[model samples]
Structures are given as C-alpha cells and as structure tokens.
Target: MIKFNMAPTARKLVNEVMAVKPGERALIVTDSGRSPTITEALAQAVAGAGAELAIVHMSPRLMGGIDPPPHVSAAIHASDVVFLQLSYATFHTDTIRGALAGGTRTLEMWGFEEEMMVVGGANVDHAEMESISLKLTERLTRAKRGRMTTPEGSDISFSLDGREGFALLQTAHGPGEHCACPGGEATICPVRGSASGVLVSPFCIEHKDLGQISAPMRIEVKAGLAVSASGSPEGERFWAILDEAGELAKNVAEFAFGTNGACRKRVTVREAKKAMGTCHMAFGDSQSLAGEVNTPLHVDMIYDRPTVWLDDEMVMKDGNILI
Candidate 1:
C-alpha cells in the first residue's frame, strides 16, 4: 500500500475550495487537542496560495457548539477566510454566526483527524459530491413533510414547512459562505413541535467514547421534544446528558442526509455522518442552521441504511439515493 500525503488535499482546500487569493488574510483557529500535523499542512497550503496566514491556538471546548473566547471571535471576524481546526464543533455558535454575517468565509473541520485529509471523504471528487449534495438540498427545500425509518426500528416524522435546505459542499469562496472540510450533506431544520415517534440510533456520534453501541439507543419524541430515552445503557446516558443541558437540549433540531460516497462507515463523527446512504438526526442548536431553537449543545445520532420519504417522494430506499 502507498502512503498518502496530506499536502495535496490541503492545497485543494486553500486554492480550489476557499480560493484564497494573494494578499488575502487567512486565519486558522485550532485547539490544543487537535492534530498539529493537519493544522500545519493547512497553514503551509495557505502560505503557498499567497495569502497572509495567522494561526490561533485555544483550549478545546468541552462539547460541540460552545463559543470560543472573545479574542478568537474578534480574530475570526477580522479575517477574509477562517479554518476552524478544533476538537469540537463551533459551527452552531454565535461566534461563527457573527463572523459569517460579517462576510468571513469559514470552513469547519471540527474533530478532523490527519487521516481524513488523505483518505475517506477528502479523497473523493469534490465537484461530484457537491452536485449530489445540491440536488438533495433542492428536494429537501421543496418538501413540507418527511419521514425516516431504519432497519433497527427508527421511525420518525417531522414537518419541513417553511424550512430551507442547506447544502454542505467544499466550495465556500464567496463572502458569508460556510462549508466543512470533507463536506457532503443536505440538511434542514424541522419545524418546532412537529416531530414525533421513535429514533433508534446505532451510533451516537457525540458519545464517541462508547463507539458503536452494543444495542441501538432508542429515543421517544413527542411534540418535537425527546420525552424519554431507553433501549440501552448508552441511551440512558444520552438522555442524562440532554437532561443536564436544560429543556432546549431535547428539541429535535436537524434532519440530514449524507452524500459523500467516499466517506467510510462507522468512523469519526465528522466523517461518519457524511457517508453516502447514511443519515443522521441532530438535537439542539438549530439557530445557525436557519431554525429558531438555540441551546448549549448539538449532538448527532447516526443510523445506517435508512429509507426516507419527503412529501410522498421516496428519496432514499435502504440507504440508496433514488433521485
């Protein structure tokens, strides 16, 4: 087997996706727990693209969606483009929202490992992935109701009224645009108080320490709130975490489909949720994604081979995209 280098992928991110021009100010926000090798590759790539580079290292946040320090937020707003190379996600935080609103192009690489740069999703054709994502986004935007079911007993339905779908693609060169590295998903916020039924997840990405749960975690939702959790010890722990996070944490927030064919099954959270034919549902912090709910946490639950329906149209059948 040949060893793959990360430099080429880093270069593609800087020159192709972000389109960092000469004299442009590029900022890289990383944390102590993140991979230094990945950060350095991105830094070198930015420099080679003829952009002024600045890197800021901060203590990692305890959970996803937490805000960074004020100075870091300030630096993000001041830059032309920013690379979020952190251990936990800041994509749903007000800090990133402010920066994007101020015309800073941001790329989120939360929980990204060095292996992600050379293999898996990053190794795929970005343009083809983007096309798949955008097409699904269009279908989602036009949908008013959606339902999903997995072989492991996940059956949930939610209204998509007035919601717009967001396509997570690699290109984010324009002002106020945001994307994720190794991105390929179409996501939308479900209407508040409109989700109900059971959500059974084979993998809870937030509790990655547990890895693939021995039993599927089952969550019962009523009126869009996850009323109770059961089915396994992991499910109980998941409920406890949400209970500790306050009432808003139980709100069913996001419904998304993975579109990256090269993404592996059952890997890290960032990559697993992008695996083609898979789907993930998230709870908490929908404000940044064009929804009303805002909470201290955002967690995703991934399940395999789901059959999904959007307004009577079968978009996915057993994890295969039909459209």
Candidate 2:
C-alpha cells in the first residue's frame, strides 16, 4: 500500500473541499498510481468534514488494466458522495466512463467539481477556485435575450429568443478522449475531466485580454461546433488539435465556465486556457467519469466576450451577468 502525506497543497484542497455532510460517505476513486496521494489527502479531508469515508482502492498493476471492478459496485452504493480522481497514465476510455455513468443516478452527487491539476499544484486556493467556479455556473443558468444565427450557414437566420442560448454544457452522454485530444501536449482525461468552460456556439463570440494575444482570432460556431476559425497559430492550433481527433471530431462535448482567477497560462495550453476565468467548449470527449457520455470528441473553445441568453432572457453581455 502506498502512503500519501499531507502537505500544504493537500491542506488547501481540503480547506476549500465541500462534500456531503457528516455521517454521509464520500468515495475517492482513482487508478493505483494516484491512489496513494489522493487517498491519503482525501482521508484527512473527509475526517475534517465529519463524513464517514471508505476506500475501494484498485491498482492497474494487479490486473494490467485500468478500469475499476464491477464487483466494487457495492462500495459506491453505500456512499452519499463519490469523489473520483484519475491521475494515472491516462485511463481506458471505457473504464472511466462506466464508473461515472453508473454512479450518477445511484449517488446523490450533491456537490461535484471536475478539473485537471498538474506538477502537484498545492498552491491552489480551494475557496477562491470554488468561488470562481460557482460564480461562473451561477451566471450561466440565468436566462437571456439575444440576437440570432442560422447555423449550418442556412439561407435564413433565426433569433435565439426563448431558446437556451448559452449553457454550462456537459456531454449529455459518456466521455471518449479524442474529441478534445490535443496531440503532442500533456492532457488531463480527454473526456469529462475539467469544469473548464461554459459552452458557446461557434457563432457566439466572447473576448478577454488577461495578459496578451499576438492577435485574437474570431472563430464561428455552427450547430454547436466550430465551422470557421481565424486567428494566430495558437488560435488555429486549437482547432487543428481537434481535427486530428477523427470523425465527429468537432462534435461539441463539454462547455466549461472557468473561474481560476489566480492561474496563469504556462504560455502553453496545458498551463493556459484551462485555468482562465472565462467560458469554453470541447468538441469530442464528453466525460463519463463526470456522468456525461455522448460524443467521443471533446474540443474546447474559449469565449472572451459573450452575450448569454437562456430561453428569451438576457443574462450576460460582455462577461457581466445580470444575475
């Protein structure tokens, strides 16, 4: 059994950690490689939360496979909340999806947050992150009234009045990595991993200037997918990465509303966009681990300036939500 120690980062994760209440159970699921670190920190965290916790720890080494066992079913059934982590050599797309799919209806899942962390980021201020995340979610759910678009480049454009214009979208299904698999870059789970962006139509435009942009591009979304994109290599590369994900590559999967106000881009995707306090959408992978499974392709498009409308109500214009 690998043992994990509590460091400042671990403490921070727990500090902002919110889960089901006392007497309720929270399960931390992960691959064997991440089990030690995750389990250790979580154990300490859960105890502090006054929640009962149990471990159904599984290792890929024992079976030479990554998926958790079907036999582990009973363990999860007993918990009120399921805290899952996948910090391994990636994971079998199927294995990850199954766990999420099976748990959603089964567990209460009262509070859920998903995001990718790297190089042991212990500096994350959990409270600040959660505040940002919740604020983004809150703004998205509000309704809005907006202009129109006839995606698919149709002969006519219809107004987005009384339609769910912008939403915190999750693949209405399970996850498959390729959808947003940016080749040659370090990645988190390709599927439902991060609560990164609140999805926008390729036709929708959101703009922001946190640090710099050689030239910010304006890409177009049609039918919930990016059809036309124009910008620097960084901007276009965002699309190129998805193009390689295969057919249905541009099928939008997840839309995350970012709130990591403190994170700065590594000047590379792995360190950048995912941490931005804005909104984004993925084309291919829909996370199954997060209980969403639909498309195999998940690509994310970040919004800098957006006007959001849910149904016929106008909620946000240029990053500020009326809610």
Best by TM-score: 1
Q: Candidate 2 overall Cα lDDT vs. reference?
A: 0.38
Q: How many clashes (backbone atoms < 3 Å, residues ≥3 apart in a chain or on different chains) does model 1 have?
A: 0
TM-score between model 1 and native: 0.95
Q: In candidate 1, which residue ranges exceed 4 Å CA deviation?
A: 1-4, 207-211
lDDT against the true structure, each candidate: 0.88, 0.38
lDDT of 2 by residue, 145-244 (tens): 1232222221111222222212211111122111110101111222222222222223222111112335555445555445654565445655565465
Q: Which residue pairs in model 1 clash with each other? A: none
Residue 141 of model 2, lDDT score: 35
Report the number of the highest-lDDT candidate. Answer: 1
Question: lDDT by residue for model 1 over 230-255, one digit each (tens)?
Answer: 87888888888889999999999899
